[model samples]
Target: MAKSSRKANSGAFSRRKLLQGASAGIAASLLTPSGSSWSQSAQSERGSASAQRLAAITPESLPKAWSREEIQRRWRAVRQKMKEAELDCLLVCQHHPGEMISERQDGDADIEYLTGISLPYKWVVLPIEGKVTAISTNQVKGAREEKLSQDRGIDVRIVDGPWSASIIDAMREASVAQGRIGVTDLADASRQAEGEVTYTTYDRVLKAFPQAKFQPASYLIDGVAALHSPEEIGVLEKTTQVGELGLQAMFEAARPGVVQRVVWLAMFNAMVNASGERPFSVSVRADGPGNSALNRPLEEVIRAGQVLSQECSGCVLGYGSQVNHSVVVGSPVPADWDAAAKDSLDTFEEMLAAIAPGKMVKEICAAYDRRLVARGEKPGALVIHSGGLGTLPRGGSAGAVGQIVLQAGMVFDVKPAFRLKTGGTAQFGDSVVVTENGARRLGRREMKVVKLS
Candidate 1:
């Protein structure tokens, strides 16, 4: 039987409230059966078979894994880039030493890659010639560092002092006095230097050793961002699989008079029950008019003729992958919707085909513009969104929305969207990797609007 919509407490729905409500809806859906006869038959069979079940399994158990060698190889590449940049040492800090924000920073993968440790409020120093030391605020235990160092065959050091002092001391110990040291402080490092009297912590480090020159580490970071190791690929692939499965579950859970939160919960449950790692974001939308793009699922009940657009991400082994799809309930796909989705997919595929090593990013953007114009769509600001998907350090750069020059080993999510003449929009996206010859789709499924009526 179709489940009735859950009543809402009186208030405007914020994103958090929507998520909370959706979680409840999802729980309810799992407990209720669909009205379909096949569903009822399956329920009956499941009830009969329950007595023959085996031992229960816990999904929280992570698989025994080995990626130390892979991480080491990536670090070697990063070290090489540091050498090319003429850096004496590279410092990767998680949060500002004294002022820690509750929110996490986005680029911890780089630090995690260099050191086989995953924690915030830490600093990783990769000297051009010497050992790599991971300095932190004594929050990490000595035994953990020893195990990580032993597993990766690298030195991991724990410093017991203020963050700035530890950083300075590590540099001094590494003999980084007279050469250029690369710092990832894209902000506040300069002012932290007390004028010429005493340079900021970064400046102080340079002053403490007059021969050391301080330089921005963006280029070196970019270099590491461009490459991916095989182990990283494995993590990314697993994440993609998780995303696909979660999406399927969300689609199966959607129905008329069902709440949008129910579909979102179904997706989340799939990820959690599959033992997928943390850092997943799932969003679901129903067919509506104005401000629908920004509309998260609310207490409003889903109708039979609505379209559900779902975007989901799964992060496993510290790598992330995303998948998006639209599902229709009890209605044929609209002609305009079909055309818009097909054209978007076609444009995305064309962009993927154009990716190759050594192609200019600007040229790729221009091609995308030309193609969109030919298809009767206006190409606005084009940005390249391509990079490595790995637990190790990865970077993404903007290219044309329609086209981006490809580089071998670069993985990307090509999602091209267009504003439809009607009251809605269309979008399709897929993950692909650039190879020596061309691009390869990570997931084999064709880009199309899926109807589940």
Candidate 2:
């Protein structure tokens, strides 16, 4: 269940304050881990769980994605920010809809955050003083994408042409031919543009509208997309809950003689089918006396002396949470394996304890130092992370630039691992939402390993 754009446009807003239709391709890749982790010689993280209560409720079980009021509230907030910035229109170019797994920088999900519907590719035009509209050359599933946009009250119009022309159409529909335009590839302040709005898109848009003043608006868009509304928090909660199903599936199925891919598919399929999630991808790896290559698959086979770890995200309405855990396949546990897991688990707990509304991300990350140092260990690895609404920090903790304070509505995945004396990583993590009181655990996935029969 990947969180890429689905559904297409039927009869909606036209190019010039009228009605027309648009047309598609696959989606871009999702987030790529940056900074600290790649440099560390330690092991990586990703995985999921089982069935039971998860099947009882799902995104499909609930008909509505966001209330009309919720969408409007979001619009109003963006508009106000636009007014403050003196921007007449904000043009957003998101990746086309479809699942892809390139090693490069994946596209952003700002469009998904703004509109309930995620399209394959979009040239969304948001006006500060007029009607908000979106134009796309990428036609999604008409029945699904179109209906969702209509239901969400978004003035989305499908058009056929170059991606740049889609921007021209959306601008004209909103009657914004010339004004100050804020251009963003939907990246936050911390990272360079990774979405579809590359130099070509921007240059094309610039030539199409020479009269308009254009400026980098990532900071502005990030401002609006930064904090999570209560409704968003609730959506994340569901993703974490569903992630539990996949996590359970992984733990239950991880055993000697099991196919590694089958174990992954068990968790992957569980999240998609049971929770109605659109998972992008998951990483599963195993290590032991004879197994070592981190990214290579295990030939779909699990063995007794292996340590298996997985990193996965269960997404609900484009909101997702990560669950990372490692297990010893069977019996006579290897020396210090469980201890490494315990240390990571304890470090996660330390992060939670350090989280508060006024705390900086670095301060929250200090828990890694405290726990690791107490264990006579040092963390040269990234221990804590945060992400939501297509806004995820690459590498390190919440403060990629080192100034992010813990806000009540922020969601994060704390993956804390200790360097194993046996030459690998013992890692654990899960997604959580920050609360006024502290960090509220959204994922109920098992942190400690349990024996599987």
> What lDDT tens digits, residue by residue, belong to model 1 across residues 261-302?
666666676564443344244666766331243324457676
- Give Cα distance to truth, residue 119, candidate 2, Å: 3.2
Off by over 4 Å in 1: 1-66, 95-107, 142-146, 157-161, 187-207, 287-306, 329-335, 361-371, 374-377, 380-384, 387-405, 421-424, 444-446
Q: Pick the candidate with the highest lDDT.
A: 2
Give the Å error, residue 53, model 1. 22
**RMSD of model 1 against the true structure:** 10.4
Looking at candidate 1, the ten consecutive residues that score lowest on lDDT are 50-59
Error in Å for residue 177 of model 2: 4.2
Query: What lDDT tens digits, residue by residue, belong to model 2 across residues 12-97?
Result: 43121110011001100111222321212111122222233454654445323555566677788888988898998888666432
* Model 2 TM-score (2 dp): 0.78
